[model samples]
Target: MSDEQIDLLFHAAVELQQRGMWEQALTQQREAEGLLRGQPSGARRDERLAALLYGTGGSLNALGRHAESAGVLEESLARYTELGAAPTLIADVRMRRAVALAATGRGASAVIEADAAVRTHLDVGRPSDLARVLQLNADVLADHGDPDLAVASADRCLRILLQPGRPGAADARYLFLAARRASDLHAAAGRPDPALAAAEIAWTSGREQGFAMPSDGLRMVVRLRESGDLRTADRFLKELRGLVPDADPASYPTPEPSVTLAQAMAATGATGVPALDPRDAEAPFVPSQRSAAPFLATAHATALSAVCLSALPEDVPHGVRLGLEAHYLFAYASEAQDSDLRYRFVTHGALWARVLLALTLALRPGDPALADDLTGWARAVVARLPPTTAEAVEIIAAWIPFLDAQDA
Candidate 1:
């Protein structure tokens, strides 16, 4: 009976590991493993042994003992098979084992196990768990000396996550976690734009919950790519090699974001697109004036899910005249030859383009009315203006993706 106390200790160890207390978690895990080994050999004892082994193996992995974790996890897997563990548990074990194997330099074996683990997850895994397993598969593939396979795995994970309802995954937090991995993979694969978009989404979501992202390196990479200054980027990378060769630990006051959580969350649903800077003192998306009618009514009527985007209305209020007033500011500025407004458009084109894409996603491929209406409205407006102006040309270019999808 004394050995049964290992179960409680094992659970606590897992909790500590999750909280990033690796050393304490490892100690508790070893204690649990030792106590379980003292138990009499029986059906219940075998099940406890399986669980304790799994916990200890996981703790080892958390503490970066890849080879040891792999051995312990393999033993746990055998005990799980012997005890006939549920499919989910079996799949979860495979996922962690794959990670350990990859870290231990057993690339081929790791990939095999990862693929099997994903298959198992697809059959019975919740979206939250599935996203994590997919990310693990991607990371292992990356370390397996096959960048292509790694990129493919990462892309697959994004597809699964952004699969309409699945993108909502478990919650905003989980979605961002998956998105962050997706961002890194995309960036590594020479796709900076998508990487930047993914990072922005993750950062935005996390910031809404007071979570700060260490995205200094990511931002620099993206800016370097945009500037197309390869030599400068290369030189910067070289400088980074020894800049932090040695460091001293220091403590400072907890930092605060430029915008508050409530403000950031509010901006998530707004149509006003602002240039993204982590330290920008101004709110990004609050329009100077509010419209009397809803613009995303059609999207709301269709199948829409996710955080703030899910809270729109199904239709414009009966008598309200919806208008794309926010979008017209650029056109009006160009027409009036307003230098300041034109400068904003030139400087923030990318963010505005991203906003347009976000808006376009609300259009369901199966339903074309909204897209048709938007296209025709833009066409009509541009027809009345000087089409050769840079603003006019750029605006149309921004809409090309949505228009092409409609044509298809």
Candidate 2:
């Protein structure tokens, strides 16, 4: 293919991928591949082929076709290895392959690949590439339920990223992920104070950089709820909702499962308060429109609204419940990381929301399996929070009694 044609295909593939038309992006990439195959082999030809394969793999991954992504990325890795490509280039492909493996549920294999990539980047003296590998390594570790190691890897990356003259945005991103993993580890270990501190750092850094990611703030709210400081937690929740207006409810990303459990606690009045109207919940706490009013005075009004609304009775309109759940999920999912917390929170929240909707609006108690599924989800959320959110834990604790009584 002509250089001009390859360039056009590459650009087209990138645009399609960005637009979330992954299938179309893959199609464009395949066309580029076919064009390249017709050309004579040379150094430049190999480089173009590598680029096409890498781009194709990325698009396939974006489309959730992980196996296909792994195949394409493997091809790219082989070509890069053959060319004796620069350290960063090889490290990048290794990172991509590791991610594809993790996505395909090969966590142990992913960790091995990611570790090698991290070592390669470190050896090559590329701090940025090292940071990326560390982040990906943390992800794989977390997925494998090794929170301590995940936190350690993330913390190491954060240390490097916070050094003098580091790139601001990327540094902020690393700090955010590191804080998130640390908070999760703290929570799992029943250390609330450290979790709270880590969450605060994550939120502050993200906000300072105008990161607009919600997962960090969502984690903070969960930790605060666990600490029995509902008032303070409300403030963070308000900020979370305000930061992500375009976030989709069903697939919103959260930093951890504790955040979703907190939302669920609010929904059931287990937090020892009445739930507020989801719409009005965020409305009262909007930080951008400050006044002398207590709710209006804070920087994150939207989250406060969520806390208030979640405390309300389940008898509220189905649409209102769904909206509240959506907001909660959206806030939780807003973080940029692909950690276990993000996955669990989004998946659990989606399942819980559906169950609530079905019970309150569509199905009867006699509906086979619905109640069981809902109960199972509630238990999962409760199991995830750390001891720091004592209020949240107590709320869930009380729920067990309540549910027991109802069952009796």
Candidate 3:
């Protein structure tokens, strides 16, 4: 491919990445990389190849393929080092690699990489780059079990992001993510007022920018309740529930054993669907089913089954059967992190699945099969979660009851 063709491919890949279609973005990046590899070795060609590798690493990281992301990033770093690339360029990749490392449970190495990136950005004196690095560093520190230091990092990043005339002040994603980080850190430090204030920024910026999740709304409600604003909390809770329908909207009238967990969750939000924001749009080819109605129907049936099961005693055979069915469905629904929607859904759903699965196993601890399955799922949840948010803390703690039962 010619230089112009390569540039076009690179730009297209970047646009796809920005739109949260990381799988397609990765494909474009790899295609460009292959074309560049066919050319003879030169400084320019190598640099182009390195840029492509960096893009590949970023897409992989976004898709939750953290181990692969870290490896690709290492290659990108080596090439940049050989070319004597700019400090900013090197720091950018270092920051992204730190996140990938942190996600994969290499907290110590992640911390080192994050600190180095932060120092480079600080010396370079670019507020936007520095703020971005600090946000990632805060997450790495928090995951590394240094909440106080993480709080400091988050506070600094928020200051940079919120500054009136700063370079990153107007960036929607930067403002929302930084505010959310600061909110979590402040809550952990027992400073409820600051936490609530910061959460307000996160809620407003996230919703307006179309990047907010169901968890974000939940966080706001929790914070409001903590601050003794019960009326406001109740109002927000009502608004949230309003987004979900009270009845099943699917065409199916009966429940099937094959209903996957993703369909169930989609059913929960069948009514009052949110607008499809371009920035949050995933790859078009992701789900085989185009609509949420069928998912909602399956979810409704599953929920009814759970209600019936709840009325039965813990040791009842029918209850056990129902629980196992739900567990298997959840397992079957687990998808690769091919797009942003899947990534977010899995991140939140996996935690709930782990806890529920553990509870079921607790009732039948002698079932070695269920016990082992829960154990593996719990470990995966811990490795993948950032452990920064209050919601994460609470959900992680939910495993304790199951653990206690197992020990008994």
The candidate that wins on TM-score is 3
Per-prediction TM-score = 0.50, 0.54, 0.58
- lDDT minimum window of 10 residues, candidate 1: 283-292
Query: Given candidate 3, what's the lDDT at residue 98?
Result: 84
Best model per lDDT: 3
Candidate 3 segments exceeding 4 Å error: 166-170, 244-408
List lDDT for all candidates, in order.
0.53, 0.58, 0.62
Task: Please give, for residues 1-408, the per-residue lDDT of candidate 1 as tens digits.
Answer: 575477678788889987889889889888877877876888888887777778777878878898898888888888888888887887788778988877765554565567667657767987667767767776765554233334445555555566676545245555565556556655655566666666666656666654533443334344354447567555644544344332211221111212222233344443333223211222111111121122222222111112222332332211011122223323233333554433544333332333333333444353244335445444444334343557656765766665566668
lDDT of 3: 0.62
The count of backbone overlaps in candidate 1 is: 0
Between candidates 2 and 3, the TM-score winner? 3
Error of 3 at 263 (Å): 44
